[model samples]
Target: SAIYLWRFGSIKSRILTVCQHFFFISFRARPLVQTFTSWKAPIIWEEMFDSILYDQGHTDKNSSVALTVFAVGRYLDAYLKTFLTSAEQHFMLGLPVTYYVFTDSPEKVPNITLASRRNINIVQVEKHTRWQDISMMRMRTISETIESEIRHKFHYVFCFDVDQEFKGRFGSEALGDSVALLHAHYYKLPKAQFTYDRNPKSKAFMETGDFYYHAAIFGGLWQNVKHLVDACYLGIIEDKLNNVEALWHDESHLNKYFWIHKPSKLLSPEYCWDQSIWDKRDILITRLVWAPKHYETLRSG
Candidate 1:
């Protein structure tokens, strides 16, 4: 009887110990694992990023900024004017800005009176018949020009579509080694639903991705931007060689590059809002991107 009681007590104690270990894993360890894997949490949290990150007073005084845009034909000229004027009014107000306007006819670039310490540098390039070609061409053009003109002149550069107008402060919160904007349409969507290039033959193909980054606005440190451009340009060349083009052209290439090399900072959909497509209550529109115009009519001479 004594032996039976002792053995039973030992078994009970071991069972209790096992229960405690299981409880710790179920209650404590599981949450830690989930926290690490949560996709909603940005790699660079919003609280840690702000204008002060790039403020000259806090860091270097000689830091300069360049804004790059391709306003290829007459149709985009009107939008470019609004983009430039609004940028002058709200973009890095105190910092030195050089607008590198890539256009077929540089003379058509609006003669806007830029703010203090701001200037425009028009870069002429041959025009392509298709808008898609022009978009892809921008990657090669920017990569080439940055080597010659922009790299020596600026510390940081921002590549923006000519269709957006700054409604609020597009300040230093955006500055980083490599910055990418979450697509306004797909930021809340699941990874499976993201419109990444799915064709295995294409260089931009990705079976899974973290975010559907918008190609409309992307830039960072000069070296980082240059690296991104070079990669996209090469990806396009490889896709062409294979007789396959990514579904979204340069945008797909940009997404693939950013997926393999995560951006240092990711801007919320607020950075690229289309008022016509999204509800105001759902998104805070920091910049208003005009709705897509009919290319046939808009691009006509």
Candidate 2:
């Protein structure tokens, strides 16, 4: 009888210990599951951004879109021909388009015969010795140009790097009141891992953020684009005043603006991809960005 009682007590104690351990694990896992469920990935889904089904023909007739690029020196001119030709072929095929080419040597711009509705306006800008200066200067030039020229001429504007080539259709489906592209490298990482300007002294600094947007591609309504450029230019000026430059120059400021302002539409990495470095299984190539030349050689005249 004594042996039976002892065995029964041991069994009961073991059962109670198992129950406590199971309950503790369940309790711990509950919050983790909630956190994952509540967290929203910044990626915009295909159904939301698909341009094929959108009535682009109707929108094209009514919209005037401007594409802006800054190719300041000789090295980038090699890329200009392909960039211009592809854009003519695939970008908003029937829309009234203007290519605002900001460059030091306007004559170097290819004399490609654009479609009747498409045209290139070469705006001469003073050449800068450093590519970094050119990158930062782009915002000031874009803001001033929009105030003086682009605002009255176009309904929408897109800014892109001159080094890229368009491999597939980059169409009106990308259009938005405000649009920003996720950086190809950091799109999948947690916000903590995003490469934002971390310096507290810089205006672009962010302790936490939702997306690390690429400055290479961004656009919106004339007003929104203007606001974006103006804000970035001002941020740069503030950094200059503080005697600190943000880590990635203009890109840092861009991420800062969109983090606070949150773009109305977010483009997937498919919009801007470095094909040479990445052969991502999930990414369908809409545009293929070429690897850039050596910074010193590319920027030097």
Candidate 3:
């Protein structure tokens, strides 16, 4: 109507069309947010994918998936159960999945029932006094484990923080040579505003880069993922030797790695969302969301 009024209708009709357009905008539904990175990797958003096709492709090949999570010290009691249970319900339903749970308290690990081809392995690990060490050391631990056995068994591996729950489908649409999840908090911000470590002396320092990736979720083919974690762990160790630390610990080093070696696929902020941060009008479907921050309580637990 606006086009017709502007092209053929009288002046008064054109004026009315403009007013009507503004009135209708209040009822507008969200539009699709579909795009790709400059390096030709897709940014998977809800409106941009065919889940069934991706699922079928992997299923027919009989590919197996592996999930890794750390629930050391306080987090074992705080967030592990909810994370594991929700994952059982929504993560890669039709595929064979093995969950590698790293925890200080193996007996406390949740007894979530699994489907036909699903299993869990409890790996007891040392609990660090500082939460930061617990988070940073995961890169070293995961890389070592992958080299030891996971590389031979799993087709793909995904590492996630125990402090989140699955809210929707997180399936084979995410499969790639290398996959990175855009940080929910920084995805919308410009590169200059991204919280990359600016310290020149640190190994994780970044002068400029693409989207900042979340430390909560990262994965890919076992080999690619191993390479990523190996590189990140090396950077972390180098920083410590030089008496410096990345601003965001492992997350900072992850960002630096991605900036240099672009990921083959990218998951939108919808993959790792946080409701408390901002509006959700931008996100059409949320797959997983951050469990509320209980830093003081969880750390002390």
Considering every candidate listed, which one attains the maximal lDDT?
A: 3
Task: Give the lowest summed-lDDT range of ten residues in model 1.
Answer: 1-10
Model 2: residues with Cα > 4 Å off, grouped in runs: 1-52, 57-61, 291-301
Clashing pairs in 1: none
Q: What is the per-residue lDDT of model 2 for residues 169-260, given as tens digits with 9 covering 90 to 100? A: 77766666677887878876788889889999999998988778898899988888989998988888888777888989889989989887
- Model 3 gets an lDDT of 0.79
lDDT of each: 0.71, 0.71, 0.79
Error of 3 at 96 (Å): 0.5
| lDDT accuracy of residue 174 in candidate 1 | 62
Off by over 4 Å in 3: 1-34, 295-301
* Model 3 per-residue lDDT tens digits across residues 1-301: 1111111122122222443211111111223443567865667767455466567667776778889999987887878888989999899989999999998899988788889999998988888886446655798789888888798888899999999989999988777678899888887777889999999999899999988899899998888898899898888888888988889888999999999888877888888899897678778888899998768868684
Per-prediction TM-score: 0.80, 0.80, 0.87
Show the lowest summed lDDT stretch of 10 residues, model 3.
1-10
User: How displaced is residue 190 in candidate 2, in Å?
Assistant: 2.1
What CA RMSD would you report for each candidate?
13.8, 16.0, 11.5
* Residue-pair clashes, model 1: 0
Steric overlap count per candidate: 0, 0, 0
